[model samples]
Target: MNLFRLDASILPGASTSAEIADAAEAEWAAAHPDGTVTRRHIGTGFFPSDAWTLATTAGFTPEADHSPAQREAVALGVALAEELRGADAAILAVPLYNFGVSQHFKIWTDLVIAGGGPATPLLKDTPTLLVTTLGGGYGPGTPREGWDHSTPYLERILADVWGADLTVVKRELTLAATTPGMEDLKDLAEQARTRALDAARAAGRALAGV
Candidate 1:
C-alpha cells in the first residue's frame, strides 16, 4: 500500500500537530513496514506564492502563449493532483495559524484545485486522516468560540469536496504548556494531546486495514 502524508508546520520540531501525526503514522508504519510512503512538507519547503495563479491562468491562455513559469506551475499542479489520486490513504497535518489555515497550505490547496479542476475529487473513496492543532480553545463558551475557521474548511475540502472517507483528529490549547498566561491550562492541554494521539493511532490502524 502507498500512503501520502503532507505536513504544514512551520516549527516542525516543536509542532503539536506533527507530534499527533507521528503517532498516527507510526501505527501505519508498524502495520506496513514494506509500504511506500510519500511525503510533502510545505511548511519547510514552500512553493512559489504565484504558482497557483500561474497554473490557473495557463488553463485559460493558449498553450503557445503560456510562459515558462506558467508551464512549470501547470506541471506542478498536475503532479500534486496525481499524488492525491494515486494514494491508497493519506494523512494531512495542518496546524491553525493566525486563527486559520496557514498560507502555505492554502497555496497548496489552490494549486491542487487548479490542476484537478475545481470540482474534481482526487481522493474519491479514499481513507484520509486530518490532524489539526490549535494554540487556543475554540469550543463553545470559550472566548475564541467560533474563531476556528480552519477545521470546517478542512472538512469541506477533504470530506465534502475530495470525497474522502475522512477522520479528523484535533488538538487544541497547544500553547497552554508554554504560553505565559496559559499555565493553568497546561494540564488540560496534556489531556487533549493524549486523547488526540490515541484517536490518531486508531485512525491510522484503520487506514492500514488492520
Candidate 2:
C-alpha cells in the first residue's frame, strides 16, 4: 500500500494540522511497516503562482498547438495527478489561513483538476483523509460561528468534485494557547486537538484496511 500525504502548513513544528496528520501516518505505518509513503510539503515549496493560469490555459489548448509554457504547465499537472492516482490512500493536511484556504493548497487543487485526463476523475473515489486545523473557533454558537470558509471549500473539491471517499478531521481553537485574548479557551483547544489526533489515527488504521 502507498500513502500520499500532502502537508500545507507554513509552520513546521507549530502546525496543529501537521501534528494530527502525523498521528494518522503513524497508525498507517504500524499497520504496514513497509508501505511506501510519499510526502509533499506545499507550504514551503509552493506551486508557482501562475501554475493555475498556465494549467487552465493548457487545458483549453489542443495538444498539437501547445507552446512551451503550456507543455510545462501540463507536465506539472500530470505529475501531481499521477501522484494521487498511484496512491492507495491520501492524507491532505491543511490549515485555515486568514479565514480562507491556503493559497498553496488551492493552487495544487487547480493543477490536479486540470491535469486529470478528459475521461478520468482526479481522485476517482480514492479513500481520502482531510485533516484541518483552525486558529479560532468556528463551530455553532461560537463567536466566530460560520466564519470558516476553507473547510467547506475543501470538501467541495475533494469530495464533491473529485469523487473521493472523504473523511474529515478538524481541530479548532488552535490559537488559544499562544494567541492573546484566547486564554480562556486553551483547555478546550487542547481537548479538540486530542480528539482530532485520535480521529486521525482511527482514519489511518481504517485506510490500511484493518
Candidate 3:
C-alpha cells in the first residue's frame, strides 16, 4: 500500500502539527512495514497560490496572465498532481494560523485541486486523513470553534473537489487560557503521528481485502 503525507509544520524541529502527522504515519508504517510512505513537506517550499485571470476565451494567455510566478505555479501543480496520482491514501497535517489553515497549506491546496471541467476530479474520492492543531480555546465544542476555518474549508475542498472520504482529527488549545500549563507541543506531535500511521494501516488492510 502507498500513502502520502503532507506535512505543513512551519517549525519542522518543534511543531505540534508535524508531530500529530507523525503519529498517523508511524502507526500506518508499523502495521504495514512493507508499505511505501511518501512525505511532502509543504512548509519549506511549495507552490505559490495563483489568481488566474478570467479570460474572454476561457483560456489564459500571456496578456491575461497577471501573476508573475505562473511558471512556478504550473510546475508545482504538475508535481502535486503526480504525487496525488501515486498515493492510495493521503494525510494532511496542518496547524491553524489566525483561525485558518496556514498559507503554505492553502497555496498547495489551491494549486493541486483547482482544476476546472467535469473530468477535473482526477484525484478526487480517495480516502483522506486531516490533522489540524489550533492555538487556544478552539477545542471542538467552543463557541468560537465555528470560527476555525481549517477544518470546514479542508473538508469542503477535499470532498467537493478532490472527492475524498475523510477522517479528521483536531488537537485544539495547545496553548490557550482554559487549557493552560502546557509547556511544549511535542507530545501532541507524537500523538498525531501515531494516529496518522494507524490510519494508513487501516487503509492498507482494507485495500488488501483483509
Name the best candidate (by TM-score).
1
Clashing pairs in 2: none
TM-score of each prediction: 0.98, 0.95, 0.71
Give the count of colliding residue pairs in each prediction.
0, 0, 22
RMSD of each: 0.8, 1.4, 5.1
lDDT of the structure predicted as candidate 1: 0.93
Distance from true position, residue 177, model 1, in Å?
Answer: 1.0
Which of the predicted structures, 2 or 3, would earn the higher TM-score when compared with the native? 2
> Per-residue lDDT of 1-210 in model 1, one digit per residue for the tens?
899999999998988889989999999999999999999999999998789989998999999999999999999999999999999999999999998888888999999998898889999989899999999999999999999999999999999889999999999999997799999999999999999999999999998989
lDDT of each: 0.93, 0.89, 0.65
Which sections of candidate 2 miss by over 4 Å?
117-119
User: lDDT, candidate 1, residue 145?
Assistant: 99
TM-score ranking of the models = 1, 2, 3
Q: List the lowest-lDDT window of 10 residues for candidate 1.
A: 97-106
TM-score: model 2 vs. ground truth: 0.95
Angstrom error of the Cα, residue 42, model 2: value is: 0.7
TM-score quality measure for candidate 3: 0.71
